[model samples]
Structures are given as structure tokens and as C-alpha cells.
Target: MALKAPSFLADAMLGSVARKLRIFGFDTLYIAHAHDDEILKMGIDQGRAILTADKELFKRVVKAGARGVLVSGAGDLEDLVHILSKSGVTSVDLGGIGSRCSVCNGLLEEKNQEQLKNGVPGKVAEQHREFYQCMDCGKVYWEGGHLRRIRALAESVDAKLGRAVAT
Candidate 1:
């Protein structure tokens, strides 16, 4: 059997990181107002590794026998690289992009243009044929200019990981 990709529960300070992780096809739960206890319980119950910038919380997570990573990089890219590296991901798979909901950490299902009548704007429908809807939040996603940016960011991440692995 194939090993499952690691899932994550990011702390409040890592909200943006959580969204990015979801976009990269990783199951990431971001609770903006959750207490540390809640975060720890959820991470353990759901089998998710806790990602946090808090040194104390990370220490507690480790003490509790839960998987956790302390992310304290200066830039968003650096943080992402750190998290991915800690998770054993040496490269980003572009194919996994848009596989999950960036907003809700939900699975995305492919949707036909005709299936969504009023869900998407008329202009967007004309510009893109492929679409995806979040099974949890009903958010629509398409290959807009954002997709290009996502691809570029993924490439940069891959390059950085490559350099790290090489040396």
C-alpha cells in the first residue's frame, strides 16, 4: 500500500501557511481562534502533525508524543520550504495543485462548466473550461492567472529544495 501524505494542523500564527499547504494538496486545518489545547487535541485525534511558530507549544507537542514542527523562518517561502523539508517532501508536485480547498482544507471535485450556472461569473466561464468546487465550502476554483503564480512558486520551491538536498 502507498503511504499517505502527512496532514497538518497549523497554529493560529501559521494561518497563511495552512492555506498554502492546502493549495499544495496537503490536508491542512487552520483554526484561527483555537486555543493551544484545542490545537493539540485536534492534531492528535486527526493524526495531523502540528505546525507552529510558538517555541513553547512545539516543546509541549513533543513532550506529549505528538508530531510537531517549529517553523520560524523570516519569509513565507522560507517557512514553506522548512515545513515541506521537515515533512520529507523534496519537491512540489504541480499535479497536486488545486487538489484541495485553500480556504477550507476540503477536497476539490472537478466540475463541468455547465454544472455551474450562476456559481461562476459569465466572464470567468468564457475564459476557463475546467473548474473545481470545494466539497466542504462550495468555493469555486479555476485555472486563472493565480494558477500561473502557483506554478511559478512551486517551481521556486522545487529549486530551493534541490539546492538544499544537493549540499
Candidate 2:
């Protein structure tokens, strides 16, 4: 298997962005109440690229000699994607969708029906044979309509970005 790209450390306000990154199978570390210094420290310590919505934090990361991506206003993904792409963050290494846990940022481990029976409802278990459990949070996930919708959205975003870049 190809090695995944470097992980990310998202600042407090960027939690939603972090979740979206996980949905794309990226290892994104999110902290809800992190100060700029703490976030930068963690990013450096963990060898993670810092993601922030604050210009000061972005500048700090750059000054401190750390890799970072400054997401534009309020975590809009198109802008985030654009900024990340500019910093060499591409979908080429993003791997399969939903491969990481949106909740705890853990890798999703494939689990059979029996392993997830307790967490899943009886009807769901009977209907679905495949399941994935978050290795960190134990949240159970199944391939249903949401997965398809998210995937479609991702594809659309990619296509739009491609077109925008080509112009």
C-alpha cells in the first residue's frame, strides 16, 4: 500500500475542517480549546502540518519554522482545498473516503457483523453484512446513503477545483 501523507493539526476553530479531512481518509488532529502556541508546539512535536483560520497563527507557524496551511474564512473547504493544494496537499495521497474516523480521527477498522452487533441495531445488522468501527471512538459505521452522498460531493469538489485551476 502507498504510504499516506503527513498528518495535520487543526486549531480550535478548525475542528469542522479536521473532520472533513478525516472523511477524506487523512489523519487530522483537532483540538477544541488550543492556544496558538500550544497548537504550534503540538504541530511541531508531532511532525504534523498545522491548519488554522487565524492569520496570526499562520504567521507564527511560518516564523517558527513549521509547515502550515492557513484556511480562509470560516473553514470553507473549497478555499481550504485550494490553500492546501498550493502547499502540496493533494488528493493523490488522500486515499479512500471514510477510511478515517470523523469523530476521533482514528483509522476505521473493518469489522464483521458479529463484531459490531452490540453497537448496531438488529435490523441494520440483518440488512448489512459489512461494517467499520472507529478504532479510537468505537463509533460504528456502515455503507449507506451518506457514504454515497459524501463521495459524490467529494468528486464534485474535485472536478470543480480542476476546472477552476485549468482556467
Candidate 3:
């Protein structure tokens, strides 16, 4: 059987980290105001590894037959990404494929130039023809200069893990 990509349930404390995971096309769920117990339950129910800064929460969930990561600090997103990447808790699939939405966890749909004219800024719509939209949240996305920044950050985390930009 093929191994599936690891899914994650990020606690409220790691909201920014969750966003970065989603930006990398990981199936990360972020519950902004979730209680510790609720977050643990979500991880159990969804079979998702829990990522939290709270050590106690990590201990609690890991004891309950779930995998988790206890983040050291909340200073930087890049650090968090590096820690998680090194832990081998999640695999980063970096082919720039449509996997997850940065805004919402919904799957992304490829959209052509004509489809994005009304959604994005005039400059972006005119300049970039290729685009993708999130089905659940209707947010538009495209490969812009920011993608290069994200790729650089991922490379900084793991040179081999930065495959998302090869597309």
C-alpha cells in the first residue's frame, strides 16, 4: 500500500505555523480557539498528528494513542517549520500541486485567466494568466514572487524538502 501524506491538527497557539503548513500544501487543520481537550479529540478522530507548543497537551494526547510534537518556542515561523521538518513528523510534498488551500483547508481548483478577472486585483489578473481558487473559501491563488519567498524559507528549513517550487 502507498503511504499517505501526514495530516495535522494544529492548536490555537500555532496559528501562524498552521498557515505556513497550508501554504506548503499540507493538510493542516487549525482551530483558532479550540480547547486542549477538543484539539486532542480532533487529532484522535481525524488520525492527525498534533502540533502544539503546550507540553502538557502533548503529553496528554501522546498518551492517548496519538502522535504529537511539542514546539519549543513561539518566536519564528521558520523555526517551527524547521523543527517539524527535522522531526520527521510530516513529509513535505513540494511539487506545487493543488493539495490544500492557504486560507481554508479546502482543495484548490485550477483556474484560467478569464476565471480570475473579477476575483483578483486588475494588475495581477492582467499580468498572470494562471490561477487557482479554493472551492470552500473562494480565495484566489497564483504563483507569484511570494512563492519564491516561501520556497526559499522551505529550502532554509530543508534543502531537499523544498520541492514545492520545481513546478
**lDDT winner among the candidates?**
1
Q: Tell me each candidate's TM-score.
A: 0.94, 0.86, 0.83
Considering lDDT, which of the candidate structures 1 and 2 is the better prediction for this target? Answer: 1
What would the per-residue lDDT of candidate 1 be over residues 1-167, giving only the tens digit for each residue?
A: 04578899999898878888899888898888988999899999999989999999999999999988999957678988888888777888889999999998889999999987878999999999999999999999999888788778878887898888888
Of 1 and 3, the candidate ahead on lDDT is: 1
Writing each residue's lDDT as its tens digit, candidate 3 over 50-109 gives 888888998998789887777766554554554555445344455643456877788888
lDDT of model 3, residue 74: 51
- Model 1: pairs clashing at backbone N, Cα or C within 3 Å: none
Estimate, for each residue in 1-95, the C-alpha lDDT of model 2 and write its tens digit.
Answer: 24446689988877777877788777789999967889899999999999888899999999999988888764345755664565554443324
Any runs in candidate 2 off by more than 4 Å, and if so which?
1-4, 92-95, 161-167
Name model 1 segments beyond 4 Å from true.
none
Report the Cα RMSD per candidate: 1.5, 2.4, 4.5
Return the lDDT, model 3, position 120: 88
TM-score, ranked from best to worst: 1, 2, 3
Best candidate (score: TM-score): 1
